[model samples]
Target: MDTALIVTVVVALTAWVFLLRSSMISMIWGPVVRSAGGDAVWAAVTSVVLYIAGLAAFALVVLAVHWALGGLPARALVLVLSALYAPVAFMPAPDRGARPYEDVRRALVRAGATEEQARACAWATGPLAFAGLAVVGGAVISVFAG
Candidate 1:
């Protein structure tokens, strides 16, 4: 196999593993502590499986792009990936009322947060999420650029 293809596979696999591990940890620990509920072991196992499936889907998409483009254009690929994930950053804003964090906050406070507080928190988190996506995109681009 070509060095680039080998490198791509390795990078994808590493990303998949990292995501799976983190997802598993969060799923197991977060819910267990947050609500004092759910089965941590099952959560961990299920999250790992789901994350692996997500990685498979991501790999397919990347492969499709690579094939269609006839080679990786690192900058373009990074831009496309960033655009695809950009929605995630904005998603928390519109539905904060229904989100788990808001639910927890409301449970603690008699009247919950004012609309402004909720909006501020949601908007603040969006930028952090975008920064995280950018970091991931940069890592991906660097791998393929090799």
Candidate 2:
């Protein structure tokens, strides 16, 4: 119930989501957005809605975790959460030619990107990217809060 703890949880959760989920939205939903084609307004609106909804859902989860770890210090909670999520982020990257990656690349190509550009973009979406963002973000938040 401490104001400082509340503020730290909110700040750390917001930063974590911005660092992680926002990128995921673009990567996972980019194809759908591009498929809107000439309807730029529709695409933009849908993207905005998705982002808002995703943020809300993610925030709820963070709040639940915060409540569950109420007895823990903010910095330790942050580190524990980060460590728990690290396994997910550290999962081996799928092969570039794997079905999901190929599907994403193909979608991008169909959406008008060149093969090379699509390939690079698809590669960038690998979960491995989450490792650095999560660890660095958690450490930074913990330091600032502590």
Best candidate according to TM-score:
2
lDDT of model 1 at residue 88? 30
Displacement of the residue 141 alpha carbon in candidate 1, Å: 2.8
Model 2, span 1-146: residue lDDT tens: 46787578557655554455434434555554565564545554554455345444544545565566543564465456564443323222234564756654565556555555555554554444454444535443543453
TM-score between model 1 and native: 0.33
The whole-model lDDT of each prediction reads 0.42, 0.49
Candidate number with greatest lDDT:
2
Summing lDDT over every window of 10 consecutive residues in candidate 2, give the lowest-scoring window. Answer: 86-95
Clashes of each: 0, 0
**TM-score against truth, every candidate:** 0.33, 0.37
Model 1, range 1-146, lDDT digits (tens) per residue? 37877476546644554445333323332342333233334433443344344444555565566566644474467446644443332222132455644532232222233343433333433334344444445545543564
